[model samples]
Target: MKEGIHPNYRDVLFVDLSNGFKFVTRSCVATKETGKAEDGRELPLFKLETSSESHPFYTGQQKSVDTLGGRVEKFRNKFAAFKK
Candidate 1:
């Protein structure tokens, strides 16, 4: 609550590049770009690589990794000398 020592907080526009999703929220981050919202209001524009709109977990599109195979292969390699 100190005066003249806090960063400016205002509405900022965050754009998800993957799905072209845009939203406005209050933040203290700095930006040089601006974007217009659905209501025709201009605000600071920030770009993001991933967001809930296109994230695999949020969208229920998670991919399964072959971690079990990797662990089995590593175990076999580590104990191969003992078996010989």
Candidate 2:
């Protein structure tokens, strides 16, 4: 491993806007804002729309798919008539 040329890896806070969930993890991502975490540790605060806590997959929430009017399916159905 080389030194001085690599990005600094430090603690970063990922805050989910929807659920107000905050978590600290080590990352190379830089941010201007900083705040003390729930554990009383100072970390960079980064705002995000979705995180593992509020994401549909991780939260086990049923997501509604808008496949009924997909353009690809419509095109395939339209071309299916010519296949016969």
Candidate 3:
């Protein structure tokens, strides 16, 4: 590994907006915000809409609609006119 040729990889804080869950881990993701951890250490902050903590799939709260009339049909109907 060479110096100065790789993106800055360091610890970053990820916050889940839905549940306000926060965690810090190593990452190279870019952010314009900063936040402090529970220990009072500041780290680059990245906001997220869904994470394993709040995701329906992981939480077992997911609802399944009949594919015949659900998103698949809605999407096909929405763009069907483009086929002509």
Candidate 4:
């Protein structure tokens, strides 16, 4: 690969803020902070609100969203005439 035209790629510590879970992976994202990984390696810190580990869909905790007055209802109502 060419040099000086690409962002610096290195290991980064991705942390799930909801559960404090952490994992290390290579990334080119920038950060002004640093954190230590499980193996004691200092890496750039990146925070995540939801990862596969903590996501509702992946955790088997997802809920149905077909609620009253929701967008689904609005769509169905608006398109009701077109259905016939």
Candidate 5:
């Protein structure tokens, strides 16, 4: 609530480069880019490498690792000498 000590927060457009998804939200990030939205309004543009639209986890394309099985196999191999 202090005056002249806070960065300006305004509506900015975040564009997902991988999927071309854009959304307007308020942020204090600085950018030198600008773009026009579908509503004919120009807003500050921020580019992102990955977003929910293109992320593997959000898109249900994430790969599941068989870590438990691998660890069990390693343990069995390491303790094989004791079994004998």
Candidate 6:
């Protein structure tokens, strides 16, 4: 309820640096850049490295891991020891 003591809350863009993805939403987050997204004329744009488009879960490209490695058996043995 105070005046002149609050940060300016406004709409801003959130950009994911890893995949060049960007989305517009109302947020208090501050940034140096500004832009307008008009209703009906706006189309949200986003780019992602894994968005069910190239992910193994969606594409059925899952790979099986070898469980015979010393690390794997060691971990299993460690848990088995605790279980006993």
Candidate 3 lDDT, 1-84, residue by residue in tens: 888998888999999999999999999998999999887999999999999999999999999878777888899999999999
**TM per candidate:** 0.83, 0.72, 0.72, 0.73, 0.77, 0.36
The alpha-carbon deviation from the true structure for residue 65 of candidate 4, after best TM-score superposition, in angstroms, is: 2.0
The Cα local distance difference test for each model comes to 0.94, 0.89, 0.94, 0.92, 0.94, 0.58
Per-residue lDDT of candidate 1, residues 1-84 (tens digit): 778998889999999999999989999988999999888999999999999999999999999899999999999999999996
lDDT of 4 by residue, 1-84 (tens): 787898778999999999999999999998888999999998899999999999999999999876766987899999999999
Q: Where is model 1 poorest over a 10-residue stretch in terms of lDDT?
A: 1-10
Clashing residue pairs in candidate 4, if any? none
> Which candidate leads in TM-score?
1
Candidate 3 Cα deviation (angstroms), residue 70: 7.8
List model 6 lDDT by residue over 1-84, tens digit each: 889998776555554554544566666664555443444333333334554445577679899787679788899888996886
Cα-lDDT of candidate 3:
0.94
So what's the TM-score on candidate 2? 0.72
Reference-based lDDT, residue 65, model 2: 91
